[model samples]
Target: MLAAIRSIIFIPVFYGGSTPIIILAFLVALFSESGTHFMGRLWSRYHYLCARLILGIRVKIEGEIRNEPLLYVFKHESMFETIDLLRIFKKPVVIAKKELLVIPLWGWIAKRHGLLGIDRDGGGAAMRQIIKQARKAVAQGRPIIIFAEGSRAHHGQRPELQTGFAGIYKLMELPLVPVALDSGLVAPRDTFVQKSGVITYAVQDEIEPGLGRDDIRDRVHAAINALND
Candidate 1:
């Protein structure tokens, strides 16, 4: 019942309170992409505060965040870490669903802010296209970020890395840094009944570029699931 009460208050507080900030972000995008990123970071910071104050959720980081440009791979366990990584990694050019690029205002701004959207149905051709886009992002001095599994999974779900991970890693020629997080423990998918808990982000060491596909995949898979282990 107490959990229910917290979720009830938090559901509205998290969404309603964030609406204004998002609206402000749309306006900020009209002027400067950098200003838009500042707003995005602000938006993420606001949620962190809300998650802590209203839902009793805390975030713990287990490793260092680098400042250099490279490939950042993350575990996608819930929606919490999706945008939260913005503040965590400062500002990375995220590889997200192509559909996100169609979401009215947010999509347009996201593209301008350097989001690389991928169409999941384009098969090998899609992977090639994403690699092409990633190259441009790298040239612009931005690190490429992606969710290893491509989509969220239930708590304890250890799905293998998506097919594109290997293609991009090999072609991008950027060191791979895997980040693991346990957000589903508290901010689970498809529900608002959040519990008080620590959502831990485990950043593993960097794997050098040019590793073989099988070798890199195994290393990244293990690293990103470190928190689960």
Candidate 2:
């Protein structure tokens, strides 16, 4: 019952409260991309507050966030991390599927903020385009965030990574950081009730560049699921 009440309050505030900020973001995008990013980060923080204060959920970090420009491969467990990571990083350029960039207002703002949209099924040519965009983003000192599984998985289920990860890693030639989190147990995918507990982000050590694709993949897959183990 308490969760239900909080959900009622959170639903309106989460989506409705951002109406004005989103509009401002749209206008600000015409002038500066940084303005939209600032607004987006503010919104992410607001959501975090709602999760803590309203839903009785807290976030606890267990590892250090690196300062170097590297590729961040995260475990996709819930929608919570999507917004949460935005606030966690400084100007992160997320590599999202092409379909997401076709959304109305949100997609427009994402494009303006320099997010990379890749055609997941477009074969080698698509991978090349993704590498180019990622390189550009890295050149500008923005960390690139990608989902190893390419989509959210069940709380305890670890799926194989999408083919693009290896391609991107090989082409970009940057250090990779595997981030693991237990978000599905709290704000689960395709659900409304958010349980009261601390969601933890366990940042594994950075995998240095120059490793073979199979070696890197094996280590990242293991490191990211370490928390689950």
Candidate 3:
């Protein structure tokens, strides 16, 4: 019953509060590019606030977040970490699936802020586009965030990463940071129910660039799944 009540209140408060921010963000994106970035942080903070105050969810980050321009490969568990990650990094350029770029007005704002759109099924053309955007983002000192698996997995399920991760890693030629989180235990995939619990985001060791594809893949896979083990 408590969970139900929280859901009822949270759904409205979260969306209702965000509607204005979204509008203002889009409007701000018109005059200055930084406005969208500012609103994005606000949007994430609002969600975090709702999760903590209404749903009783607490977030804890373990290990230091390195301040280097590099690629960030995160565990794909749920949307909780997805939004929270925006707040974690400074001016990150997220590589999101192509569909997200077509979401009406939100997509336009995302593009304005330099988020790269990924065409998962576009074969070679897609990879070339991703690499080009990633290279540009890195040169501009923005960290790139991508999910190794390319999609969300249920808690305790370790899925094989999509093949594109290697292509991006080799093409970008930057240090890699693997982020591990157990958010599915609280805000799970494809579910409306949110449980009250603490979610830990651990940043593992940074892997140097210029490694073989197999070696990089193996190290990142193990690092991200370490929390599960």
Candidate 4:
């Protein structure tokens, strides 16, 4: 009860105070890519802090992330996992839905931070765009992180893996790191209420770049299920 109350009260104050700061941070991110990376890191630090202060939830990470220009296929459980990645990796180039880029200030900030937006309905063309943008990001020496499921999963169920990732794996021909997150549904979806709990992130084995697309997807799915079990 106390936790719920604290979370409820903290929402308004937290967002009210953080909005301006986020805008200022976004502006700083727009001018320079390096600055965007730095600000992204800074935003993640503050985001964790705010989550703790408001919801009493903590984040824990397991496994080591390899330092190389590669692709990270992560499980999309909730928005938390997305924010958490800012702290886990360096200068990550995220693949997100294009709709998010339409959001007012937040979308603008995401664009500045080097996020790659995809039109889910663009079919094969979307994959081509991803490959084009991903090549550029990888060339800059940043690991590209894609939520292979493409969107958040339903409560108590694993999300269906999307096939677009296969194109990325085949085109980029870089190492693919499988990432899994546990307990992200604590916050649920379409609601601001947060349930107090610990969310765990695990980085599993690297799938060598040469593997067939199906092989890579199978490996990543198995890794994610291991976490669920």
lDDT of 4 by residue, 1-229 (tens): 7767876786777677667778777778657778877877777777778888778778777888864688888887788778878877778889988998999888888877778898888998887887898788888898888888877774456666787877778888988888877755576656666788888778788788878867877888878756776
Model 1 residue 93 CA deviation in Å = 0.9
**Candidate 1: deviation at residue 127, Å?**
3.0
Best by lDDT: 3
lDDT of each: 0.85, 0.85, 0.87, 0.78
lDDT of 3 at 16: 96
List model 2 lDDT by residue over 1-229, tens digit each. 7777887788887888778877888899889978988988887898898888888888888888754579999998988998887788878888988898898898899888767889888999988888888788888888989987989987888888887788788888898999999999888888787778889999999888888878888898898887788
Off by over 4 Å in 2: none
Better of 1 and 4 by TM-score: 1
Instruction: Name the lDDT value of residue 118 in candidate 2.
Output: 90
In model 2, how many backbone clashes occur? 0
Clashing pairs in 3: none
Residue range 134-217, candidate 3, lDDT tens digits: 788778788898898889999888898888899888888888999998998888888788889999998999898899988998
Clashing pairs in 1: none
lDDT rank, highest first?
A: 3, 1, 2, 4
lDDT (Cα, 0-100) at 2 in candidate 2:
78
